[model samples]
Target: MKKKSAVLLVLSVLVIGILSYIGAFGLNVGDYRVKSFSQMLSKGLDLQGGVSVVEEIQGKADNTAIEKTIDLINLRINKLGVSETAVSKEGNNKIRIDVPGKFDKDEVINLIGKTGKLTFKDPNGGIILTGDDVKDASASISQETQKPIINLELKPAGTKKFAAATQKFLGQKITIYMDDQKITDPTVDVAITNGQAIIEGSASLEEAKNRADIIKSGALPVKLKVVQSQIVGASLGADALPKSIFAAEIAIGLIFIFMLLVYRIPGLMANIALVLFIVLVLFIFVTIKATLTLSGIAGLILTIGMAVDANVLIFERFKEELKLGKPVRSAFEAGFHRAMSSIVDSNVTTIITGCVLYALGIGQVKGFALTLVIGVITSMFTAIIVSKHLISWAINIGLINKASHFGVNLRGDNNA
Candidate 1:
């Protein structure tokens, strides 16, 4: 049993050490890659720098209308090829948009908040069809003309209306407009009852695609006015990231030293568990694709302290049991068993607080709460399971048998 425990302890330490190194420095073997936490985790607007805008509905709108407006705005932003953009409804009548990375604020605002009402009109300025009548729009190169064009698919009603307009105005120009701005004017050639048509005046395929995406996103169900806008500079985020990482490194380093000094062997086990805790939390973040913000880093640092606190409690219990002349194995078991309640109580309360913050808060606060909750739960597992098993294995291997090894001095007693 002692031999088995020694081998297991060594293997566990090796695995944890390797994981910790890889988590910090990443690994690339052939095509398979494992990114470091800094590279794997997504950064929020506050961390990466970007534009954030909030818009308010101008008039009273129902739930369905507000939801539809949000969907349309998200579609518009996505079509703009903005990755990591967040579009969510805030309050009852407001929508918040977060676009990460550097971008022109005005262009983002216009693309996201605009009421893109597309219309087809005759040369006499009479409306022939609205965006609602159009079923789909796509940008492609014309097979015959070899020019950029926007292909339009119309609804049954729009097909009839467009057929009539084309027949009546054959050889005349029919204009298409988006938000009163003219897009294309094509002369009717052969008018038929087909539901398909093409607009062909784009100078480039990129412009054609932009126009098609705008038209395809459809109009917002309700008018919205921009209420707030903020821009974060990329330089600010760039500076903050290194400082935050440095601070975390210093904090964790101090924690590792303190644990090793105060509790000796048990402290060493706790330190190993702490490293595992950090790796597990980071793994969860990467798996869930959670965005890390500045506030989120604060939460992570705070939980590191909490994770140490659990080990402190368990080690103290172990020392108490040793002073009572309990065998090393019994004392180890008693330590974890007695500390379990306190650990669960503290961690559960913290998790509840994190839940409340996540439910009530927005933006950075939400990020903080999410990180805190994940850290707390992961810390609980490390302290209760990983740390317990590590110390148990060390004790079983006869590496830890005396009370002095746990910083406990039973001078008058033979327990040592």
Candidate 2:
């Protein structure tokens, strides 16, 4: 039964793999050969020809921070109901954003382009400050009233500035600005000594909740100017997917073969993990309706390589376990456990990179970064969970004998 379950799992993964390659578009296996590579998948802005918008990020440049801004921009594009949008940042203070053509180009622009504006005001109501000076924002409640509010903390300089503003505007409005646009206007009743402030103007339950979250997530530190914007046409996706997939396939193939040759049995499991990793990642992308921009495709390919690297780590550890003459199951388990540390450390580091790219990178690079992050996460799952399940299954099926566990050989390779 255990072997059967594992076989079923492998079969299920195989079906998913075939489907992903074919995509959601109606597939006639007979007609599959006749279809152009373009028909197999969607295109991004660069390929389809859509609008690209470049903007200036406006302050404090950490490569990491800038990358995160880029990721956020891509998220906005995703919300606009388009897939394959490109969003990234330029130099120290600018963002480059793009997406494919749409009938409502203006709407897409508005959706992807706005800076998050969140505000708060004093009860007496006179202007104080906005999200611009906030060093951080988070969800909390007023100490006195215990009502939900977004806590806003200003930068050191911003703190002094906000304190002064609150002192002067006591009994007045302190509106939050997102891209110089007002979000919430909370009232300030007294001078605030702490850098902390609260935003109290959510119009609805959901709105308030969202405002609280935005505050917690922290708003864009500075104002951004949209330097450029354009809607790309549909033709781009057709052109891009083929090239992207071709690159990804070649890379994955090379990695698979390399693993098999270098590590033997363990390498085979890693390769299987890699394929499952790809399937899960793409499945998430399509389900999430992520816009598949050119940079996004590039990110996906990059993740493919990383996923294989994760497998390699595990397989290498398996070698250590085998050399110790541990039983097959014990060796497999030990190797997986040992490899887990490397896999996690590497993936976490990459995730941080992705987060930065998402934050400040903007446009297509942002897309790539977001996809890369997602792919990394999904890779971890397939590598740790899916791969283990497969190996355990093989052992259960009597695929490996007592001698086979240590100096073994098998017919065909799982990854191949």
TM-score of each candidate? 0.77, 0.54
> What lDDT score is found at residue 12 in candidate 1?
92
Per-residue C-alpha lDDT of model 2 across residues 107-129, encoded as one tens digit per residue: 66575546565444444444444
Per-structure clash totals for the candidates: 0, 76
Question: Judged by lDDT, which candidate is best?
Answer: 1
- Cα lDDT, model 1, residue 56: 92
Instruction: Tell me the whole-model lDDT of each prediction, alpha carbons only.
Output: 0.87, 0.66
- The C-alpha stretches of model 2 lying farther than 4 A from their native spots are 1-42, 53-99, 102-241, 263-266, 402-416
Weakest lDDT window of 10 consecutive positions for candidate 2? 407-416
